[model samples]
Target chain A: MHIQVIPVEGLPIIHPGDLLTEMICERVTFEDGDILCLASSVYSKANGYIRKQDEIVASAEAVRIAQKTHEDPRFVQAILDETTDVILEDPFILSETVTGHVGVRAGVDHSNIEDGMIILLPPDPMGAAAGLQNEIARITGKEVRVIITDTCGRSFRRGQTGVAIGWSGMTAIRDFRGDHDLFGHVLEITEEAVVDEVAGFANFIMGESNNGVPAVVFRNCTRWTGHDNLHFNREEDIIRKALCKK
Target chain B: MHIQVIPVEGLPIIHPGDLLTEMICERVTFEDGDILCLASSVYSKANGYIRKQDEIVASAEAVRIAQKTHEDPRFVQAILDETTDVILEDPFILSETVTGHVGVRAGVDHSNIEDGMIILLPPDPMGAAAGLQNEIARITGKEVRVIITDTCGRSFRRGQTGVAIGWSGMTAIRDFRGDHDLFGHVLEITEEAVVDEVAGFANFIMGESNNGVPAVVFRNCTRWTGHDNLHFNREEDIIRKALCKK
Candidate 1:
C-alpha cells in the first residue's frame, strides 16, 4: 500500500496542565485507522520542558545516584534536562512529556536546539499511544493506531534507524519460522520486526532535513490492531541488539 | 554519480584453466572504471567447483574441524566443496579459484544452486579487481576501478549487506570530522564506508530475484582511485574489523 507521511507543525509553546491531546489533534489531520508516528523531541520542545543552564545545580540526591555510574555533575544535569521521569535508575531510562517516546534518556537533541534547552523523550509512550488512538477514535469515529517513534542507535550498523518505542494497534514481531525459503529449507532466525521496518521506511520519507512530515498513514496493514499494547518489545530483548551496543 | 548494474548470464559452465577475464570481457561492454561485483558461488558453479553428494569419504581433518565448531558432516562437505587453496590455516580464511573472491570458506554458496553443485567465491578478489580494472582500461582507454563484492553476514544486523571484499582505485573511507554540522559542532563520526555504501546501493538495483545485473558502473566518483587500500585509524579499524572475527 502507498503510505503518505505528513509532518504537522505550528503548535504553541505548551505549559504544565495544558490540554496536550486537544492541542496536537487540532493541528494534525486524523482519519480512522490511521497510524500517527511522532518524534519525542518535538513533543518536548512544544511543551516548554526547557531547563536553563543555571538551574542545573546538582543536589545530594542527584550526586548519590550519579555516583553509581561514576558520572560527573554536568552529565547528571544533561540527563535531567532530557528526562521528565526516571523509570529504572539502574539502567537509567527516562520518559518525556512531549512525544510519548520512552528510552534511555529523552532525545534531548543537543544537535539542533539552543545550548540551554534540552528536549526529552515523551513520558509513558505506551500511554501516549493509547491516548492518540482514543483521541482519533473520538474525533473521527474510526479506530486508529498510534506509534511514537524515536531514532536510536543500532548495535551493528553505523547509522541509527527508527524504532517504535511506543505503539498502539500493531503486532511488533512477525514470526516466520515455519515458512519455507527459496531453497526449501524451513526458515529459521528470520522474525521480521514489522513495526521497526515500517518505522524505518517512514523515516526515509520523514527526511532528516526539515521535511516537516512527522506522521505517516500505514493503510491496509490488516494484521495490526490499535487496542493492544502487548506487542511492543524492546530491542535489547532480541539477540540483534548486541550489534549496536558498541 | 549514475551507476548501472548488469548481471552476467548464459555462459557455458566453466572449468579449471578457463580464461575468465578475456571471456567475460568479450560478453559484456566495459567502460574505464566500472566495478564488477560477482557472487563467488555463481563463479564457482560455472567453474566446475562441485563434488557429487554420493562422494561419501569424510577425512579426519574435516571431521576434527567440524567437531570443533559442532557443525554437521554435510556442512563440512559444503565447506570442503568450495575451498581450493588454504591461506593461513591458523586464521582459517580460505581462498577459492572460481571467482577470485577470498574469505571464510571461499563463498561456497548453497542458496540458489541445484543439488550436487557448490559455488565458490571468486578466486582472488583483489587480483580480480586489478585484472578487471586493467582489462576495462585497455578496452575503453579510460581508467577504471574494479570492486569484487560478496554478501557476508554482519556482526550486528540480521540480514547481509554487500561489502567490498576487494577493490581497485577507490577511497573506501571518507572522513568528514573537521566539517561543520547544521549546528556547527565539530562534525565527528561521519567517516562513511564509501565501498560498503556504494555496494549497498548497487544491491538495491541488483536484486536477488533474477535481475541479471551483477556489475555496476559508478561515474563521477573520481575521488576514488584504483591504488591505495584504505588506511584505517585505530578507532575505525576497531569497529570495521570487530564485526568479523579472525
Candidate 2:
C-alpha cells in the first residue's frame, strides 16, 4: 500500500475551543481506507503548550523529579530550553505516559521550536484520534483510519520509534496461532506487531527533527479492520509485549 | 548520515574455491566506502551448498538435529520442496531460527525466482564479510566496511532484524559513559547498541522479500569508524540484570 506520513505546519496557538479541522484543512486531506499517522507534538506546538525555561530555574520540585529518574536537574533545563515552558509535572515517564506510551520525555518535546514553549501530548489522545478519524471521514466522505503517534523507547533496544499512542478504525494486531510454517510446524512466536511495524515504517517518512510530515495514508493492507479500536493498551499492548517476548 | 540496504539477485551456485566477486560483479556493484550486508543464505546458494533430500531419509544424524530444534521429519521434506538443487544439513540450528532472519531457509527464498531451488547462507559469513570489504577496498582503493548479516532473535522482542554476524572496518559499539546529560546526572543507561541500530536502519531498505538493492552506504557519520570491533549475542543474554534500588 502507498502510505505517506505528512507533517502539518503553519497554525496559530490552538486554544481549548479552537476548530482543529478548520486550522488543518488546507494542507491536510485524507481518502477512504487511507491510514493517517499524526504526531501530537505538532498539535501542542500550534497551541503554544509549553513550559517556560527561566521559571523552572532548578526548582526543588524539578530537582526531585530529575533525581527520581536518575537524571540531572540541568537535563530538565535542557528539556525546558526549547521554550519558556513548564509541563506542571514531570514528562519523563518511567513506563507509559499519560497517553500510555513508553516514549522519550513522556511524548513531551521541546526540540526544534521556539524557546519558552513546550509541547505535551494531546489530552485524551484516544479521543483525539477518533475525532480526527471522524472529521476526515465526514469531510472527504470516505472511511479512513487515524493513528495518533508519538516516539517511544523500546525495552531491549536503544533509541525510539514512533508508536501508536491512539488509533481509530484499525485492527492493530494479527493473531497467528493455527498458522503453519513452510515446514508444517505450528507457527508459534510469529504474531506480527502489526501496529509497531506499521509505525516503524511510517517513521522513515515522518522524518527526524522537523521535516513536518506528520500524517500518512497507507493502502493495500486488506487485513486491517474498519472498526473503532482506540484501546491500544489491551490488545496492542499484548501483541507488543508478546513480540518483545518479555 | 544516510544509509540504505539493497537486495542483490542473479547469484550463481558457489563451490568452495569459487570467487564471489565474479559471481556478484555483474549483478551487484559497489562504490568506495559502500558497506555490504549480504545474507548468509545467498552465500550458501552460490557455493552449491546442498544436502540431498533422500540422503537424510534413513540417517539418524538428520533425525537428531531436527529433534534438537523441535522440527518434524517433514522439515526435511520441506527443505526438499525448496531445493533438490543444492545444499542441505540435517537440521540448521538448535534455536527457533528467529522468525525473520536470513539463513538456508528463512531468507533462502524461492519466491523471488522459480521453484525447486534453494539458497544457503554463505560459508564462514564473518570471513566472507572481511574478504568482501578487502576486495572492495582493493578495487576502489577506498576504505569500506562489510557486515555479513543474518537474522537473529531478540530476548525481549518477538520478531528478528538482520544483525552483523561478521563485520569489518566498523566499531559496532558506541559507548557513552561519563557523558553528561543536560542535567549533569551520570548518563548510565546511554550506551548505544551501534550494530543493532545500524542493522535496523539497514533493514528498511533491504526489505523482507524482493527489491533487489544490495548494500547501502552511510555517509557523513562522524562516529562510524571503519574498524572491525563487533561481537554478536542474543539481546536477552546480553542485558545486565536490573539493579534493585532500595
Candidate 3:
C-alpha cells in the first residue's frame, strides 16, 4: 500500500471561538477515505478549553501537590479539575481523565499557545473527533476519518511518542484473533493498535515547537474491520493495579 | 511537509541464509534520503535466528514458570535463554533483553514460520540495523536510513503497536529541549521518540496475518537533531519500580 501523508500548514494561531473545522478545510481538500489526525491541544484551543492561570483558585489538595511537583498551584488546580484519578504526584502528576485515558498531567499543555493560558485535553475527545468529522464531511462532501492525538511517555522507553486520545470513523484496534499466518498457524498477536500507530506517524511529521503543524492528512490508507476497545478495564490492567499498590 | 509511505511487496517467504538487504533492494529502488523500516522478525529469520523447539531441554525454572503460563517448558526455556531479567512470570512472561529492551516473552514469536520452530528477535539489533544500512548503501549506491521494528504491547494502552528495536542513520529521539513553541515559550515536551513513530506507521501498513508486505519506505521525511538515549535507566523507571514492588 502506498500512502501520502500531508501536513496541514498555514493555519493561523488558534484562539478561543475559532472554527477549527473550517480553518482546516480551508487548508486541506478532503477526499473520501482519507484519515486526518489533529493534535488534541489544537482542538482544545479552538474550542476554548484553555484555562487562564490567574483565574483558578487552588484547593488544598492542589496546593499540597504543587509543593511536591514544583508547579504553580493554579496550574495544578486546572489539572485537578480535569482529572478523575491520580496515579502519581511527586515527580510529575500522572492522572486519568474521565474519558478513560491516563496521561501525564491529564494531557495538559502550557506550551504552543498564548502565554498565561494552559490548554487542557478535550473534555470529550471522542465527541470532539466525531463532531469534527461530521463538520468536515458537511463542508467538503467527503468522508474522512479523524483521530485526536497526544504525545505520551510509556514504560521502559525514555522518549515520548504520539498516541491517539480519541478517534472517529475507525476502530481503535484491528483484531486478528482468528487470522492465520503464512504457515497456517493461528496468529499469536491478536490485536493491533492501528489508530495509535497512525497518530504516532502524524506526530512525527508534526514536530513539537514552532513547526506550525497541528494536523496531518493520510491518503490511500487501507481500511480494516475491528472493535473500539482502546483503553484497558481498570480491573484487568496490571500496570494500573501495580501503580495503585504504591 | 509531505512524505510518501510505500510498502515493499512481492518478496518470497524468507529463510536462513537469505541476504535480506539484497532481497529488499530487489523490490525497492532506494533513494538517497529514504527511511526504510523492516520487521525484526523478518531480519532475524533471514539471519538464522530461529531455534528448533525439540532441541531444547527445559530447565527447572522454565518448567516452574511454564506451569503458571500454560506453555511448553521448552518454549519457556527458549524465552529464558534470551532474557537478561525476568520481569513477570505469571499471566505472561515479561522480560528484558541484554540490549535493554523490555518486551513480552523477550520478543520470541511462534507464528508465521514453520511448525516446531520459534523466531527470536535479532541478538544484536543495533548492529543488524547498521549492517543493513551499510549493505543497502553499498549495493544501491544510495544513502538510506534503517529502522528494525518489533510489534509490542505497552502499558495502560490495549493492543500493540510497532516499536523501534534498533535504528541507524538517525538518532532514536528528536530533542527540542531549548526550542520555543509558537508563543516563544520554551517547549515543555522535550524528547520525541521519532524512530518508534516511523516504525509504528510502518507496522500499520505491514498488517499481520497473511499480509505479505513487511518493509515500508518513507520518502521526504524531514531531519532533526537529537541523541540516541532511548532506554531509561533501571532506577529511574517508576513503572518498573512499581512492577518490581508487586
Q: What is the C-alpha RMSD of each candidate to the true structure, in Å?
A: 9.6, 10.0, 0.8
Model 1 C-alpha lDDT per residue in residues B1-246, reported as the tens digit of each score = 222334454444355556555566666666655555554444454456555544645677667666655654555566665565443232233433343333455555554455544455555656667766776667657676666666543322233345565666665544444554344555322444455545543443343433344554444333522223333332443333333332
DockQ of each: 0.09, 0.09, 0.89
**Residue B100 CA error for candidate 1 (Å)?**
17
lDDT of each: 0.50, 0.48, 0.93
TM-score of 3: 0.99
Fnat values, one per model, are 0.03, 0.03, 0.88
Candidate No. with top DockQ: 3
Which lDDT tens digits does candidate 2 get at residues B1-246?
222334455554344456665555455556556556665544554456544333435246435646754655545444434332222242242121322122344333332223334344444556677787777766656676776655443332334445555566666544545554332444333334445444543543443343343443443333432233333223331121120110
Give the best candidate by lDDT. 3
Interface C-alpha RMSD after superposing true interface residues, each candidate, one decimal: 7.9, 8.6, 0.7
Q: How do the residues A1-246 of candidate 1 rate in per-residue lDDT, one tens digit apiece?
A: 322334455544344456655666777666666666665445555555445545678867567767774655555666765565554444343333333334444454443345544555555666777777787777767777777766653322334445666777765544444555345645332344445555543443343333355555544333522222223233522222222333
Candidate 3: deviation at residue A211, Å? 0.3
